[model samples]
Target: MAKISAAEVNKLRKATGAGMMDCKKALVEAEGDFDSAIEILRKKGQKVAAKRADRDSSEGAAIAVVNADANKGVVISLNCETDFVAKNDDFVALANDFAQLALNCTSKEELLAADYKGITVEEKL
Candidate 1:
């Protein structure tokens, strides 16, 4: 197997928001192929999501915001499997960011399809 460089792992981490170890493992498993590494990371996320699909996610945060015009309002909710994760500062900030993104959305589909940073809001979540 080819050696996985730290730079490569960091690049993958930035693109996928995956952990350092995960990015490194994916890169190793993909033999340093960036696209393949991304797919592997995505599959890992999907697997985790499927496994947790039936789990109770009653813990999280909700944020409501009004546009600068004061005419449009949006509410966003982010749910997590654990109260600890829900209470995390990053998690709360993410919920707030979603609320701001929601201001531009006319429907749930639009919100999901909208871009947050460079990726779709759905992908971000």
Candidate 2:
């Protein structure tokens, strides 16, 4: 087995906003390969999403942001299945990030189609 260092796990955590243990597990599963580790995490996410696809996600963080001029702004809701997930600091941060990105979009379709971390925002949803 490849020796996975704390630094590698930390790097994946920084890049993916995943928990330390999740990152470490992904790193170990991918045999310490960075890209493969990320892919592994992504697939895990897909599996989770598929499993919970039927669940209602009414709990969420509503984020609003304005541009530097205060003239342009966007409001977005990032939803999850539980209050625990919705209340998570990381989840709120992700919502804020999406609202900030929406500031650049001209329409809902544009926002949905926008690229987020190599995939569309709709895909992220």
Candidate 3:
């Protein structure tokens, strides 16, 4: 496989909104083909973000994640019904859980279907 360069990975990240490492891996897996790498990310559910697509989310708090090396990070937001809901313990916990889930999830549906606590993602949502 061809080695993917940082510039190419950054380009893919800009185009797909995926993380740097994900983009790099996808690029390497696709032999440095930008569109193919994009397809790879999409299959992994990272190319398109489903949570961000929900137009119904009008209010929420933002979240971020720093890698183990603390050199890179990702940020996201959880939309809620109100400030009171945002302040609720359950809601805060849910947001934290989903943020971690997003690190591996690419689409909203898969994220919604992921395991959480003892319940299925669908049940939690």
Tell me the deviation in Å of residue 106 in model 3. Answer: 3.7
lDDT for position 49 in model 2? 86
* RMSD of each predicted structure: 1.8, 2.7, 16.1
lDDT against the true structure, per candidate, is 0.90, 0.89, 0.75
**Number of the top-ranking candidate, with TM-score as the measure:** 1
lDDT of 2 by residue, 13-70 (tens): 9987778999999998899999999888888888988999998989999988899999
Model 1 ranges off by over 4 Å: none
What CA RMSD would candidate 3 show? 16.1
- Candidate 1 has what TM-score? 0.86
Worst 10 residues of 1 by lDDT: 116-125
Among these predictions, the greatest lDDT belongs to 1
Each model's TM-score? 0.86, 0.75, 0.44
Cα deviation at 95, candidate 1, in Å, is 1.1
Q: Lowest lDDT 10-mer window, candidate 3?
A: 46-55
Candidate 1 vs candidate 3, TM-score winner:
1
